[model samples]
Target: MLSCVVLWSGRRGSRELPRLRPRVAPTSLTRVDFTELVPEPIAFLGQAAYIQLEAFENLARAVATAPSLGAKEGLSAAAGVALRKHHDLIAELRRSGVEPVEVMAPFAPATDRFREASVGADWYELLLGIYVTTGMLDGFFARLSEGLPNELADRVRRILAEEGASQVLRHELERAIAEQPGLADRLALWGRSLVGDTLLVARSALRAAEPSGRIDEDVEPVFTELIADHTRRMDALGLTA
Candidate 1:
């Protein structure tokens, strides 16, 4: 597919945020589709992406209204920044053929997957992960930017008060496993797949980012490292079980 990314802001004050990090390998992207992009990652961690987006936005607004954490603002404002940049991340990824998983469009359906499945939703930690991951992605994007754009970074810090969605999900999942006992194996296996698939697909983002703009080589190594570290954590937690 040959196309140009047109980021036409419908409103003013719509700054052109940081571009994507780098190019992904075409070979890596060849067999993937939008659905495969977001698997039922480790007890459905992929679902957390959308939830966290919401978490940060809520926090941002709160901060704007009342001073908190000694910053004179809440987390909502910060999430706004990340949400705005997420648009760019999608553009950059799609331009090079890394389409987002469409089923997550509203970011609500995934929540239903675990809403009443006996797992208490750890809203807190997932919220935190949302903030942290936003920061990680934002920082990587900024460094890979033409001028090291930090728009995403700002939003991430703003949502700093909250815990990551992953942590919450992990805790809940752990509890579920502890009680079920028999389900542990499945969860652990699923967790491994999530980690594996994430790395495999991640390459496409790298190649996708390459042609349209210049991304720091440093960005990929860092991103890869983060994913690996995250995967290790999940593995230790037995997410697949």
Candidate 2:
């Protein structure tokens, strides 16, 4: 269920239950039409790809305009790697028969809303936002890909496998935070805000994708694990969880 959200978002972009194992498509789920099920997840992946591309491009442009030659070089390297990953993911979606435009259309509003809500005031905040959002999406997708059909699952795995942009962002963030010692607490708060906005957008996305009321029990654990992973990521960044 949460994988659906993760996969769906992958086309775009957890908690834990105690004693809980991740859900496999129950035998009963085998009868449910995968074609019907797959569309939403694919849609998510498309939207996510678009958002990542847009954000990275924006970041690259910003860095290019800055006075720092070193920053520009870092941005160039990271953007090159990130773009390749996104292109590959998009190509895989096409091979899987996903209609990129139509699939991604519905998710635009939610993703856009998230972007709007998370507009950072400065470069550091903006960079951290990118890091938090991408990491969160990637973590969820990595866990959820297991339940997908092989072809689709393979694409998800590939997309999550890269540490390109986020790794670059983390290095930049560490440097920025080190330079301005007081920025850490403020950025930590900003990170929390990003998590909140992501959940809101995710919930909106789940509702749009699932059109059937609340998420079912099978997916509940996956959501738990996703949140837990998100917390760990925040901690890794020296943010308050």
Candidate 3:
């Protein structure tokens, strides 16, 4: 299975955070020939770009109201990363000779609804929400890219790999949990609640790619891996998934 290491600080305690380097299991859908499952190229690019823009917007808002200077700085850096990715994706769209705005417009409503439904009630909840949702979607997009032409696939993979914010968010969440042991139960619940909506966003992307608008049963293993990766992430945080 394809794997990546997630490194975080701190040590294990009874229901407490641990210094972790958990391996994320492969969540790729390429185990079967899935070229036909790839979405229309323009649709894929537009949705990917818009999602990054949304992430940038959310992080920027969090930076504005962050409780501490450290948190503000951390979130601001992550926002910059998201913004740059958005700009890069837009450039890719322009290279394909489409107006970036118009292409992205079609996806706004669905993505917006996903964001609203997953929005957190407070700072900690918001941070975990972003971490979980973005992590899953980024992995999903990377997997989908495998079916794209080689050049586009390479570019998309590179952009997704520049996920510095994931580390920052993980660190922030771990710090919060380490400081407030009582928060583990609540955040654990919040993390679990996010998977259904996040998976819906992912499935919708695949459904849009299919002419019949129905996902294949073969896709089940892909999602199973996604959920496993998600469970590992929550486990790293010493939370029950």
Candidate 4:
């Protein structure tokens, strides 16, 4: 049985952007320079789009491999819901005059590295990754998006609203754990590994996003929130942090 409610209660609240904005060069500035203007938000959106795209594709594969029609249909339905939001995010990027490809370029290494490392993981780990890791990242971006311009933030909220996949994923993992009590130990360890790997990749992406040394002060608070949220998520799934 899941022991924690913090996952539902401790969601990062939406925060509006300050009225006094930083003076940025034009939005039409060069790709390299544009990152300097709004590095984390842009990078966050870009990485979000890339990760969601990959996630839906992976879910589709899982659907295919499912043994029962019931399971396949449930997974498929979740993926279908996710697909619509995925397209919406791409459209929003274009509307914002940002090239999805250009913004996503910098984080390719980290995302790709994560995928490569998980190549041979078992099905439970994959489902748990979707439920825990991806869910947390989605929550993080959704919280940050609240501080963006209204248009961009609305699109991101749409992306974040596609929670069907995570719900289905969480159910599947919980059923597995309930059926096989011993599996919890292994999955708990796997969950920790996933968290560690995710942090490493996130740190690398943060470094790339913030080239200036000034990011030091900003990182600590953001990480404190992330770590706290991560612990909540782990506890919700009956796993130790």
What TM-score would every model get versus the actual structure? Answer: 0.36, 0.72, 0.83, 0.73
2 versus 3: better TM-score goes to: 3
The local lDDT score (0 to 100) that residue 27 gets in candidate 3 is: 52
Q: Rate the local accuracy (lDDT) of all candidates.
A: 0.37, 0.61, 0.76, 0.61
Preferred candidate (TM-score higher): 1 or 2: 2
The residue-by-residue lDDT of candidate 1 on 1-241, one tens digit each, is 1111112222332323322232452223333122212222211222334444544454454345332353322244454554554454444335435445663464454333322221212332333233333333333333333221244334333333333333433444455567776565654443333332232223323333444333334333434443434544555555421
Model 4, C-alpha of 113: deviation from truth (Å) = 1.8
For candidate 3, write residues 55-144 as lDDT tens digits: 887788779878899999989999999899899889999999999999999889989988877668998888888888888888887788
Q: What C-alpha lDDT does candidate 2 achieve relative to the native structure?
A: 0.61
Ordered by lDDT, highest first, the candidates read 3, 4, 2, 1
Superposed on all Cα atoms, model 3 deviates from the true structure by an RMSD in Å of 9.5
Worst 10 residues of 1 by lDDT: 1-10
- Top model number, TM-score: 3
Q: List the residue pairs that clash in candidate 3.
A: none
lDDT comparison, 1 vs 2, better candidate: 2
